[model samples]
Target: MDEDRIMESERHQIEQIRELDLEELQVEEVENLHGSSDDDTSGRAYRDEFTFDAGLASLHTYLGEVEDTHHRLSFLDSGAILNLPLFYLEGVVLFPEATLPLRVIQPNLIRSVERAMSLVDVPYTIGVVRIYRDSFDGRLRFASVGTTAEIRQYRRLEDGSMNVVTRGLQRFRVRRRWIDVDGAPCGEIQIIQEDLPLRIPRDAFGTLPPLTSVSSPGPSHPTMSNTSHIKRQKCREGKNDFDADSEDSFESELSLKEMRLHQSAVESCYGCDTIDESTSSDDEKNVFESGGSQDSVTVGRSSQSNYQRNTSDALGVGRKAISQQSSHKQEKTRMDWIIMRQTRSHGVPRAFWPFWVYRMHDSYCLARKAADMWKTIVRAPSMDGFTRKPDILSFYIASKIPVSESTRQELLEIDGISYRLRREIELLENFDRVRCKNCQTVIARRSDMLVMSSEGPLGAYVNPYGYVHEIMTLYKANGLALIGHPVDEYSWFPGYAWTIANCATCERQMGWLFTATNKKLKPKYFWGIRCSQVADDMR
Candidate 1:
């Protein structure tokens, strides 16, 4: 009976543990529920293989005669000169490529867009200028050859700007600009038409010395003349192939595919030390076995071997050239850095930007010279003073130095500034401290220190007491003014003045103060009283 009872107790404990475990799992699942929702919303899969049709399905009506010759011959004589006002902006565009969105913000351009849209038939004579230089003088210079852009979609903004998308059709040369002050820009442009030759020129196509008859027994070296001829032929052919159809394919489809394939091949080969040498041979053999002509067998094998050897030699030469170039570039960069450092150390401001560096250096030099002159005139305290220092000397000198906030900050950051400035600034700081202490003592002795309540601009009552505090003496001449009344009770502040206090000992101004108006604290009537000599003497 005891054993049976113990077994039942064990089963009851197991049941309780399972219940606790289930409750914990339920809580964990509840927490994960929110995470699962986020997972569902995030990391959307993108289509990996996307293709776009870039070729023109039909010949555009606006396009002129499609030339079918080589050398990109344009019928400049037959083409009409379309006058267009050009606004230039820097960006790249290829022929037969359509940019979807562009924002035009000029006033004349907006009018032009409106006029163009209002016409029953859209004008097909828009000229594009490749922006070269943007100047402060409001004049824009452009490249000689610019693509012709055809507006597809035009929209006007609330702010009188126009948004449009233009497809670049062809390139043109600007003949002349006729500026219409009241209307849009008008310019005579020569439309460049491409009519490249289909075959290589007779001069370039001269029988390449019959390629040294590759079948003949020789060193198996491709002759320089043959190579040169092939290279020239390729170049000439490339130039001749620059037609609209060729351009469209090259710009939009084939070039992109080539780039992608090249990138993939490079990435695949990355970090690979060895390539399978037998792969090319096996491929060639397979082709030969798969019904390749007997005449092509020897020629094909030699060509394949030659290609492989050439590729290896080229890669080796490229690596060596790259290493040499990298070493030269590093040396050049180091030399440039050293030159920059030396220039900076000599107190010459290093040229950072192309044009503005010299201007900045000139401004700094002028400011520094003025600061030096001002330092000579100002006398600061040598020892702790019982009486205040004279104020005019400090005020006059500090006012003369027109330093910017950044320059002042740099001045303040100087290590051992007091010693560096020959105790000039230190003395000035000490003078303010002494003056404030003396003022406090005098007010305390006279029982004139008053606590006044005033209403501020925000309709809040503030109670303030008169306690003299140290104010930087240099600030007084540095566009700092005091605001308050002259007599009774006043406060001294920077950049607003009411009453002035002069030192009795030196007959020089000391500091300013703001006094309560009509013996009552009012926000508007309260202003600062300034005294330069008194503040200096006290210091």
Candidate 2:
């Protein structure tokens, strides 16, 4: 009986939707059609971990494959060019490691899917790109960089449409595009090279004492986690303890002037010479005197290039000349032996890459950086060290981070693992800088924002009659005033009443504020700001 009632209600709602034009339907009409004037939309906000984790795991597994596996399973060869079916989406950008759920209802889109499925070898692969609509002439423009979508699962509907789930496998740049006879857009594509983590050269700047020898310290830097700082220190100290016994006789002969020059060179390389004397620690001085302690180098994202450049220059006249050539050669040989043994022990193919490359791949370091990036995406108050493979972490951030489409697209185009991680770190660190669009006034920081939707801080929620509304949620705003009385009827969030919030200075409708009708609700009040209203370009 209950099922029958639900069916009847749904049938009635559909009839109402058909009678009233979708564009013309008012908010009251929508509520009446769905019989949801008393409905609380808040229940849908809570996320289930099982679904999220399963999806994440699938993506991780797909992207975590080795280079050879990716090659064997690839749908297209590197140089081979072919026209493939294209699907253009709005307000969405797909990354190579993400999965996109699509509904194919239009005749052209359905035909495109059918054509792709008819292929013998790789029946599921198709080209997916973003379409940007112009504000002036209202013309659609396709993005140059697009991803190849591999249809993982699909179901045909009675209406000849299909529901499909696809994973993004590789990035391709469009060479040319044309409409096919069936009205489906097809594109000739060139595959973009996959970005992998690079090996740090043992002598990155040839003959330069690695930055690890430098000693000048205080509190840990923001770019690296505290745990990494401690681990790096402990590892360096352990190595130094062994070297101390061997170097004791040689250390006694070194002049104080040479030691001072080495320390100065390290300081210059780290851009730490500007530090005040009062802030320098006695512990730091002791470490520098020991000549074995590795203390100063904390190469964060922004300073990686700088550290490389300065270290090359610092090598000049800093203990290298005075150190016996035979002793240096022995040390280099020992390092080579250790690297070779590691390569052989791992059974990594010698043909795959050079020994030094594998050493610099440094899985442990890359994993730590990936963990930090994950913490940023989830908006954790502090770093939560969840180790993930670097490639998986890159795709996770690219797919999950709640930034503007343009920012996400920029991340998609970036090619190196280290560079991509750095870019994500920069974006996450700067997520809060929100300003007004028209007058260039400071509005609200990301810290003050509260995400009330599953989609994220910014989300698109469609009404019962299929009207799409893009909404951004925030906790506070600087120059906005509320208009009209709070309405409890048909509130999106349960047990809350909403009032119109408009810019106090410009008087434009910014968004709304939802306050709990039930005093016991956890979030007493929250704001939903429109992305179109706020200025994201701080510059």
Candidate 3:
């Protein structure tokens, strides 16, 4: 009876994710539940295999080609000190490459939209700025950096209100602001330069030379012209074959010798034993086998990688060649590394979509940083992978991070993609120590953060009356007690009931938890913490 009871309890605790139900969730809502797929490399155990749609299917028609920079530039171009209608928002700041949805009902905003649509030179363009109320004066203040939003779609409602969707085009500084004759706020703005696109020179990389480059055939090695001719012929015919016997012999003898030379050279440089040949060979072999191919292979090194080859395996390498070969190898590695780092740090596209991004995306430091951040937010999952484009990933992080409005606004203003990501990563690392603002009592650890919504941990959810509620969600609370019975009405998580929870120590309202009433449903319960309530010391 006790074993059965324990099994029952375990079943109730296990959260079963329903992959099919993801289609019903909004893009932002989905982001709240799952961190960027980049968390897989974090080395955590909570690696939940999830597929997200991002709900961008509808925007296919409206998303302009990124390569057509001229098209977007035309819409955003403005001389310094030009006047434009403004749309003011509270608790929200838009970034370039992000999407914002708005409803125009107020007379001032409606006029602004109309005036924008009427403009011939720059139609459907408006300035979006965030308003913050000063604590001392209790007056609203606008941020300096605002984004230019281009209206992509619009609809007229029966009540004469306009429902419009806008995509952020460019970042601009608010040079000045004035109230228009029609009671709308207008701004004189200066366009900010978009960060330079990272581009790598394709010609700098040479095709893979024949694997025979490392053969120990004394001075009898084939010349470069002969090798090049054979490779070119194979490419033309598209029927290249490698005999297993030859490959096996090369691996056991030539490869081993090359590795020995590399290991010895490294040891000599650092004055310490760097790698053991037999042991390292087994591991390298396993990695090579799992990696599955030698063609198109590029080797990368890092300060943290367990092993690095000096690339000193030329044919007929003698005692005198070791120093010269090592020097050449070192120089080559340095140059290749510099090129790779330059390409990756800028997040430039090297090849075609998806595949190219994956091919060149190897920032070991960035990957390790992401992994550490994942450890703070959730306990088990390692960072799986991140989006190819840094800007897209930046917006996703801005939308999902469980930080206050001011913090998110600060993130929005950062022009550098890598800088923004690094800042968020820092926030994640420090946010682990969550404490009560009033008493400094620890409420929940970062691991307790559970993604309950599709929009991410923090999202701006509109209520029935169109009032937007920016919420930060968490999974479970350590120092909170449930106040009342679960309420079903207007609950965001479908099929679940919400109950208010408060801090046990201070008796202050913290957040709520949604519980599944259905016995068969997985994730019997999860918590949602208000971003406003929790104190993030990192801020």
Candidate 4:
């Protein structure tokens, strides 16, 4: 009886996610600070995913065949400054290469879309900036750092609203913002030239023995012929073909002092680790501490990982090469590390590094590491294809990583690709739990997450009041209280009826519960937790 009771409780607790519902669920009534009780108005303001018109998807129709320095199509070919229609969304923090879908209903925004589409010289480009309310003051503030979105497709609705699909192109700094005469949000923005991916040259990096041999493509490890090198990893043993933990072999080869220097260098660049404990804010300290080991695959500890083994083997990096480093170096340190070269470079470009010093913080290494970690965390499409394009890989990971908006915003504001990739690697290493932002109550484990949309585990969707809400789907959650009765009205997930969900401890609205509206739907119920209200938590 007790066992049966426990199983029933687990099911009710949402510990198990039912099978996926492949059908599209159009829901509008998202309860938020912006939700309204008006039925007619709700239909226009809030919307869900819809099929896009294939004819309108061609970029050549709206834009000339102009290319930016990065090889991406852009309206501005030569100038650093671009005047674009700006969107200050409540919860959207777009990163480069990410896709943002919007249901435009407001007259001002609709006009802005039309204007962008109609322009001949620099058409279909809009600045997507994040606007958030201050917790202390409740005032709306716009982020200075934003991404330029290029409209890819659009369809006009009968009610005069438009469904738009936009892909982020570049990160820019807002120089000026104003409501145009047409009432659209417009900004004069300075395009921030992104730092190209940098890595320690192969000659400079020759001192270290290879861990995995599959070379990585890109500028990271250039050969004499300028051919790309392959890179792979060993994520410990299991599932995959390789069983060697190459990280173990790689770390043991480096001199103790060299490893320490590398660790310190990585910490300083990643932030908070080099932070003065006495002066650092509580939030900063908490973030660093949470990054500590919560599970076997920890940030600092050397644990059995199938990821490292598989990656190392594929790279053609042999265990023999890794074991040979001890012959050159005298001291063996207790610590195990995988990256960085020097403790300090004093703002010098990586390209200027003297050849004698070993280069460990190669952007490619970080990118490959991050991609491998991403694979281990979620069952998504492979990130191996991105390991070569470290810059895009960094942004792609930043866009889809299952964390809070504020964390994603921080990624958008970061300057260099290596720096951004390092930060993402750390976040993935420490990402484990979801907690209430206000009261810090544990809500769910990372393993409990579900991907309801192709965008990823977390996605931005609009509410009835034209506010974008970034919500993450989960099979089960704890310390949550369901508010109001379940209602299918304007449901976001078509087969699921949503019920308001709040943190039981603080009574703060966390997100919602979506119960399968149809009995045949695999997952009888699921939970949608607002990413804004959840925090990256420690175990």
Cand. 1 Cα-lDDT:
0.31
TM-scores of the candidates are 0.26, 0.52, 0.52, 0.58
Better of 1 and 3 by lDDT: 3
For candidate 3, write residues 278-344 as lDDT tens digits: 2211122100111213211243222213333334333446344445445545333333322322232
Q: What TM-score does model 2 achieve against the real structure?
A: 0.52
Q: What is the C-alpha RMSD of each candidate to the true structure, in Å?
A: 36.1, 14.9, 16.0, 19.4
Runs with alpha carbons beyond 4 Å of true place in candidate 2: 1-80, 134-138, 201-377, 380-388, 434-444, 448-539
lDDT of 2 by residue, 1-539 (tens): 12234334433453353453343322210101112222223322322111222122122222122121132236466555667899877656777656566657778888998888776656678898877656489687778888888877676767676666677888889999998998988888888776554333322333432223233333322222532453365366543433333333343333333333333443333332111123221122211122123322221222335545654554564466445435554343333322222222111121233333433343334446556655544443343333335665666566655555666677787776666766666666667555655565555655554556443455443222212234556555566666545666445565667666666666555566777787556466666665545564632
Listed per model in order, the count of residue pairs whose N, CA or C atoms clash below 3 Å is 53, 0, 29, 40
Candidate with better lDDT, 3 vs 4: 4
| lDDT of each residue in 304-363, candidate 4, tens digit only | 243344444534544444455464332213221211111122211233333223223567
Report the error of model 1 at residue 204, Å. 5.4
Residue 244 miss distance in model 3 (angstroms): 43
How does candidate 2 score on lDDT? 0.52
Candidate 4 global TM-score: 0.58
Candidate number with greatest TM-score: 4
Model 3 regions more than 4 Å off: 1-83, 97-105, 114-122, 135-139, 150-167, 197-387, 435-441, 453-455, 478-491, 496-512, 515-522, 532-534
Measured with C-alpha atoms, the lDDT of residue 472 in candidate 1 is 21
Candidate 1 Cα deviation (angstroms), residue 67: 33
